[model samples]
Every structure is written in structure tokens, then in C-alpha cells.
Target chain A: MSVTLINLFAVPNGKEDEFVKLWEAIKVDITKQPGFISGKFHKSLKPDSRFNFINVAVWENEEIYWKAFEKSAAPMKEKLHQMGVEMTPALFNVLFEY
Target chain B: MSVTLINLFAVPNGKEDEFVKLWEAIKVDITKQPGFISGKFHKSLKPDSRFNFINVAVWENEEIYWKAFEKSAAPMKEKLHQMGVEMTPALFNVLFEY
Candidate 1:
């Protein structure tokens, strides 16, 4: 079954623009990987919130999602880490839709 | 501007089926309300995890989303509360797509 990935991100204050630039590059590379269905990046409506960014994506399954992340997105992920962006990812199976 | 809403849910053990049923009713009513863009219910891949469900949705904005939820989904929300489902919601604006 396909899995949904929700990644929560915390970026340093006043670094939104820089973070978005890095994410643009990472998003381009990651979406090209096998089993990547669709995805989007979101910024919190509440500007002062600590966890201010979220990345939502759908992949064919958990394995392919991780494979793509490790193979194509690891460097960018590292770049994000170096920039002090904290990320927490959770995966789920879609139960229902309408 | 459009807003994305991610509602994290923690359902008790072995109550997946019951939770899904309540969510089905909720999804139906909520989607019919004005400003309700779209949504999906997701169940965690790991059954043993503490947080086992998530509701991802898009709305026209924060105001309309709350209006819709209050007008149409409050009762169901209460039912979920009575069933011991814990919910945490975060709102966001779409930052980018690829």
C-alpha cells in the first residue's frame, strides 16, 4: 500500500527565505525519485510557531520512500541539518478518502 | 490565501475500526461545508505507535475552516472526544509545489 509521509520542520528564526531556497533545490531532486507520487511544502499560518514548516508526500510504500530519501535526498538532508533545520518524519497508510 | 490543516489524532488500541467509522461521518459532513477544500484520513503504518491517525485537509483560510468545523463538525468532534480520541491541529499556508 502507498504511504503518506508528514515531515515536521523547525527552522531558525528569520531564516525562512534561506530555508525555502534550500528546500526548493531538495524538492526538485526528491520528486524525481521512483515511487514519489505527489508532495507539497507548507509554512505555518502562525508565524511565531516553533514547528513552522511541514512536508507532505505520498509514496508507493515505505521502502521506496526511504530508498529515494537515502539515494537522492541525503545530501540535501545533510545540508538542511547543517543549516540547523530540525526534522521529524512520520509515515502513515491512507485509511479513507472522499 | 488557502490554508492546509493537519490534525494529528491518537486513537486507543484496537479501536481503529470504530475510529474510522466516526471519521467517515465527520468527513462527509465537513466536506459539504463552505470553504472545505479537500481532505484525507490516514492510519499509521505501525499499529503499535502512540499516534496512529492523521487528518490532512485544505481550506480557503483559517476563518472559513473554523466556521465550517463549528457549523457542521462540532457534534462529531464531541463524539470523538467522548470516545477518547485526542486531536491536535496545526494550520499552514502552501509554500511551494513540485
Candidate 2:
């Protein structure tokens, strides 16, 4: 089954632009990976939201999703850490929709 | 502009079914409200995920979203509290897509 990777990022207040730039750079590579289907990066309208940025991406399945992540995102761990960006990522199945 | 309402839910381990039932019940009313565009309820494939369930919904705009929430969800606050479901909701704009 296709899996949705929902990653919520707690980006520091002043590092929004930096975070986006890094995300865009990562996206360029990740989207070309084997199972990538689609993705959307969202910025919270409310500045005070605990998680200011969220990335929702669809991959063919769990294995492909992890493979893509390891290739595209794992290397950038240090950079993200330096920016003080905390990420909460997980694979989800669409339980219901409308 | 259309706004995405992404609400992450930290539901107790064994109460997953009960939580879904309540969410479905809320969906029945919320979907009929003006400006309601689309919605998806996602259940994490990993049971250990910090947020086990997420509700991603789109509305015409922030104003309409808050109004709909007040009308459809505010009343169920007590029930959700009893279920020990914690929610983190925020309205977001599409920053980029692919």
C-alpha cells in the first residue's frame, strides 16, 4: 500500500527562510527517487504554532519511503541539527477520506 | 486563499477504535458546513509514533475554518477530553508543492 510521510518540523522563529531553503534543496533530490509520488510543504498561518512547517509526501510504500529518506535526508541531519529544527516524521495510511 | 487544517492527535494506545468512532461522528457534521472542501484521516503505520492519528482538512480560508470548528467541534471538547485524546491543530498555507 502507498504510504504518506507526514513530517512536522519545529523550526526556530528566525530560521524559517533557512529551513525552507534546505527543504527545497532536499525536495529536489527526494522527488526524483524511485517511489516518490507527490508532496506538499506547508507553512503555518499562525506564527505561534508549535510545529511551523509540515511536509506531507506520498511514496509507493514503507520500504521505498525509508530508502528515499536515507538517500535524500539522512545526510542532511547535521545541517538540520545546526538550524535547531526538530522533526517528527512517521508513515501513515489513509484511514478515511472525503 | 484555501487553508489546510492539520490536526495531530495523540491518542491512547488501546482507544484507537473509540477515537476513530468519535472522529467519524464529528466528520458527519463538519463535512456539511460551508467552505468545507476536503478531509483525510490518517493513522500512523507505526504504533509508537508520537502522534498516532492526524486529520488533514481543507477549507475555503481561516475564517471559515474557525467558524466551522466552533460549530462542529467545540461541543465535543468534553468527550475528547474524556477519551484522553490530545490535539494540536493549526491552519497552514501551501508553501510549495511537487
Candidate 3:
């Protein structure tokens, strides 16, 4: 089944711009990967929200999602870490919709 | 602008079904509220994910979202708490999409 990757990022207050720039750079490469369906990068309205940035992306399936992640996004972890942006990512399936 | 409500649910192990049941009950009323747009309930693929369930819902705007929440979903919070389900909900705007 197709999987949705929900990645929540805890970006330090002053690092929001840096985080967005890095994400834009990563997006350029990841979007071209196999099985990538669509994606939306969201910024929380409240500055103090625990996870200030959230990415909701869809992949064809779990295998392709992980493969693409390893190839394109995994290498960018060091830079994200340097920016003090922590990420909590997980794959999910749609349980219900309306 | 339209806002997305991303509510992450940390449901205790073994309470998945009960959590979902409560969510469905809330959904029926909330979906009928004014300004409701769309919603998707997602279940994490990994059993050990920190947030087992996530609800991504769109509303006409933040004001409408809060209004609907106060009218329909707020009352159910006690039940959710009793079920050992913790929620972290935040409103977000789409910064980028592809």
C-alpha cells in the first residue's frame, strides 16, 4: 500500500530560515526519486509549537520510501543536526478519510 | 487562508481500537460542523512509533477550526484522556507543496 511519511521537525527559534533553506535543497533531490508521489511542507502558525515544521509526503510504498530516503535525504542528516533541527519521522497508512 | 490541523495521538499499546473508536465518534459530529473541509486519519505503520495515530484535517480557517473544536470535539477530550491517549494538536499553513 502507499505510505505517507510524516516528519515533524523541532527547529530552534532562530534556525527556522536555515531549516527551510536546507529542506528546500533536500526537496529538489528527493522529489525526483522513484515512487515519490507528492509532498507538502508545512510551517506551524504558532512559533512556540513543539514541532514548528511538519512534512507530509506520499510514496508509492514503504520499500520505495525507505530506499529513496536512504539515497537522497539520509545524507543531509548531518547538516540538519548542525542546525539543531531534530526530526521525528514515521510511515503511516490512511485509516479513514472524509 | 485554510489551515490544517495536525493532531498527533500517543495511544498506549493495546488501546488502538478504543482510540480509533473515539475518534470516529468525534468525526461524525465534527464533519457536520460549519467550515469543515477535509480530513484524514492515519495510523503509523510501525508498532513502536511515538505517535500511533495522526489526524490531518483542513478547515476553512483558524477561527472556524477553533469554533468547531469548541462545539464538537472538546467535550470528547475527557474520554480520550481516560483512554490513555495524549494529543498534540497544532495548526499549520502549507509553506510549500509539490
Candidate 4:
């Protein structure tokens, strides 16, 4: 089973666009990792709430995700925080098969 | 770039577990897609609201994702719904990477 991660975030009011821009800046480097399939970023349609942004990723497994997290996510995580982004990421191991 | 998809669902009453169970049931078949990596699913910590479930998936791209959707997701989607899973899956093409 492939494990997918969903991270919910609050983009500190007006800083949402900046958060997206920053992600745009570093995307290429992150995609270079092995076992990375692809990922998408989404913001809540209703912008009135503080919980506005979401980041999702597909990887080969925990190993690949952790490796990429060290080399890619660490710096970006810091940058996002500096830009006022707050989030909680939770992981789910695939236990279901259709 | 990679695209990750997060689907938030309002699991009717106690059906959250069933929803997750159903997803688990079909996850393996879904991962067979060519561009597949891995994915995870998470539910809200506060389950007071009916909006208590989340499904996350990472794919190779829109093309691969769509292919998987056609071959694997259609049936699982129906099963999920039959088990009372209601969700909105929005995708954001990768706009950032670090």
C-alpha cells in the first residue's frame, strides 16, 4: 500500500500567497528525490477560516519520505514558519486494498 | 512537480471507521498504477463534527492519477459511498517544492 500524507495548515491571514510562492520556489529541488510520485497543494475554498492551506505528498514509503524530508522539507518547513505558516502533518500507512 | 490530493469527508455518525476500513480494503489495488508512490489517510482529532475523515493520495501526475482513478478508484469510491463516505477531493498541481 502507498502511504499518502496530508498536512493541514493555517497560513496566517495575508501570508497565504507568500506561502504558496515560497513552495513554488523550491519545488523543483524537492521533486528530484527518488520514490517521489507527485503531490498537490490546496487551500480551503472558504478563506474566512484560519485553517486555510493543505499540503499533500505521495512517496515510495516511509524511507523515501523521511529521506526527502531531511533534504527538502527541513529548510522549507523553516521558511514556511518564518513566513507565518502553521500546520500539523499526520501520516497514514495504507492498510486497505481495493 | 508532484500532486497530492486530500479529500475531506463528513462521515455520517459512526461510519468513520467503516470509511477508513473501506479505504484500507482497496488501497493495494490502487497503488499498482505506474506513477504511484505512496500515501496516507488521517482523521480529525476532534471527532465531534461529522466532518471526521480525511483521505490523502500522492500520484505521479494528473495523467497517472486519472488512470488509477478509472481503474481502481471508481469501485472503491462507490464502496466508500455505500458505506456512507462523503468527501470533496481537490487537487492542486505542485506549485512549490523545497
Candidate 5:
């Protein structure tokens, strides 16, 4: 079963461009890791939400997700934190699709 | 430009199956609407998360998303509420994909 990893972040005002550039680099680097299927980055349409950016990634399975997370996510998360972006991450098992 | 709608639900411990069934019906019904591209339902891999169920749908764009949401989502949300499922929804604009 493919698993999903959703990372939601809050970017400080006026730092959207810089944050996206950092994310772009992370995304490119992580694609080289095993089990990375696809990834999509999204920005909130609502202006008021504090945590407005979301990165949705699909992996081969739970184990693979953890492997990639440890190798790629750990460092990327640290970098984001250093840049002052806070992230909330959650993992999921896809049940049904239509 | 495609838009994504993510609905995160918190279902009572024993009602996951019932919630999925209701979601199945809603999914089938909503696919008949315009601008409904695709939908995926997922369950939390982490056992302790409060909001475990997620429905992710891709739409043509913001306007079309609103149209489908008003037609399908409004009623389905009401039904889910009646069934005691609490949902949090967010809309997003695709920024980058890889």
C-alpha cells in the first residue's frame, strides 16, 4: 500500500518566495531517494490561515516512507526550522480512490 | 490551474467503517459533478492522531471547486455532521509538482 506524507508549514509574511526556493531545493534533492513516487506543493487560498503551505508526497509504503523521512525529511526539516518555518507532519495509508 | 480540497475528519473510534461507507456514497455521487477530477481517501497510519481520515480531491480550479463544493460538499458535510464526524477543510493552489 502506498503511503502519503503531508507536511504543513507556516511561512512568515514576506518570506513566501524564499521559503519556496528552499522547498524547491529540498524537493529536487529528495527525488533522488528511494520510494519517492510523486510530490506536489500547495499554497493556501485563504489568506488568514497561519499554516498555509502544504507538501503532499506519496511513497511506496510505510517502511520506505520512514527511510526517506529519516534521510531527506530530517535534514530538510532542520533547514526549514533554521529559516524560521514551523512544520507539522502526518503520515497516512491510502484506503480508497475514485 | 488545478486546485486541491482536503477534508480532514475525526471519527469516533468504532465508527470508521460507517464513516467510510457514508464517504463512499458521497464520493460516488460527487464524481458526477462538473470539475471533479479525482478523489482519494486515506486513514492515518499513526494510531494517536485526533483527525485520522482525509479526503483529497483535485478540481479544475477555484471557481469550479466552489461549484462542486456547494453542490456536493455542503450536503455531504451536513450528513457527516449528523453522523457525528467533525471535519476541517482547506483549499490550496498548486505551486510546484515533482
Candidate 6:
């Protein structure tokens, strides 16, 4: 089954550009994952700066998704911290199918 | 092709519950549309209140997706307007697929 993972979190507002640079660096590894079907990153646009980014990644299955997250997120996380992100990720499962 | 639609907008802060009620009411019509695949809504957890919602809705194609939006979004939009939402919907096209 296809599953969507909504990863919500904040990176320091001023470091948005730097955060993308770090994220792009991990693309090579992230793409090589077994279940990495797709992903898209969205920033809270103008007049709204509370939440930083809502990243939705679609995967083949939960098992494969976790493997990718375990390997890829930690290092990128370290870099995000160095860039001054202030919060942990908030996770949500996708549940709409018609 | 599967496309994820990221709908971002602001709704009055204290009326989150009312928003859900309006959303759920139209979900029935929403589910009956062709190409409707999935949808998920997320909110800022804490210490962040600028952006109201990050809603991710997936579709089989752009055609069906737009039609569904036209048929279903208008009325729910009005209810939302009556509730004091002060922004236009910000649309993002999904560009990730492996």
C-alpha cells in the first residue's frame, strides 16, 4: 500500500536557505532508499511564519519508510541543529483514499 | 500520474474545531469525485500560530483534481469565509516521484 508521511517542523526562519542546502545534500542518499517513492517540501508562505515546513513523503510501505528515515534523518538533523532549528519533527499518517 | 496538492491557508485561530466540522461535512462529496486518492490535514503543534493549516490532498491527475476542487471547495469556502478566514488558498504542485 502507498502511504504518505507528513513531517512537520520548524527550522530557524533566517536559516531557510541554509536548511535547503543541507536537505539537497542528502537527496542522493534519500533517493537511493528502497521505498522512496516521492517527496515534496512546502514552506509556510507570507504572513504566516509560525510553522516552518510541511514535508510530505510518500513511501511504498511503513517498514521501508522507517529504514530510510533511520539512515537519512539523523545526519541531516545534526546539520539542521547547527543551522539553528528549534523543534523536533511532528509526524502524521495519511488516511484518505477514494 | 499521482499528484499531491498542498493547500495552505489561514483560518481564525480559535475556530479550528469549526473548520473541521465544515471540512467533514463536505468530505462526502469530496470522496465521490474521480481521481481522488488521498488527503491529510496538519496543524502547528505549539508555540507556532501564524499558519493555520497545511493540507495535503493527492489526486490521480490534475484534471480530476481541479474539477473536484471546483465542485466541492466553493461552498466549504463560503462557510470558512463566514468564520473569518482571512487568506486565499495557497496552492503547491507536487513534483516528487521516484
Using all chains and alpha carbons, the TM-scores for the candidates as numbered come to 0.86, 0.97, 0.98, 0.55, 0.90, 0.56
Q: Which candidate has the highest DockQ of all?
A: 3
Tell me the TM-score that candidate 2 gets on chain A alone. Answer: 0.96
User: In model 5, which runs have C-alpha deviations exceeding 4 angstroms?
Assistant: none
Instruction: Kindly list the per-residue Cα lDDT of model 6 for residues B1-98, writing each as its tens digit.
Output: 56566655567767878776666666777778888877676554432445455567777876777788888887877877799875434434432332
Clashing pairs in 5: none
Model 6 ranges off by over 4 Å: A87-91, B1-22, B28-54, B57-98
Instruction: Estimate, for each residue in B4-65, the C-alpha lDDT of model 3 and write its tens digit.
Output: 99999999999999888887888899889999999999999987999989999999999999
lDDT of 6 by residue, A1-98 (tens): 66566555567657877766666666667788998887777655432545455567677876787888898888877877787775434333443333
Collision pairs in model 6: none
| DockQ of all candidate complexes | 0.73, 0.92, 0.94, 0.14, 0.84, 0.21
- Say which docking band candidate 5 falls in: high
Write the residue-wise lDDT of candidate 1 on B1-98 in tens digits: 88888887888887778999877877878878889888888888887655688788989888999888678766777887888888767898888776
Residue B29 C-alpha lDDT in model 1? 84
What tens-digit string does per-residue lDDT give for candidate 2 at A1-98? 99999999999999999999988898899888999999999999988899999999999999988888778787788899999999999899999897
Error of 2 at B79 (Å): 1.0
Question: How much does candidate 2 score in TM-score?
Answer: 0.97
Write the number of the candidate with greater DockQ, choosing between 2 and 6: 2
**Candidate 2: misplaced stretches above 4 Å?**
none
Evaluation by TM-score, superior candidate among 3 and 6? 3
lDDT of 2 at B33: 97
lDDT tens readout by residue for model 3, A1-98? 89999999999999999888888988899889999999999999999999999999999999998899888776788888888888999999999997
True contacts reproduced, candidate 3: 0.97
Scoring the B chain of model 2 against the true B chain gives a TM-score of: 0.96
For residues B1-98, write the lDDT of model 5, one tens digit per residue: 88888777888878888898888888888899898899889888875676688788998888988877777777787788777888878898889889
The C-alpha lDDT values of all candidates are 0.83, 0.92, 0.92, 0.67, 0.83, 0.64
Name every residue pair that clashes in candidate 3. none
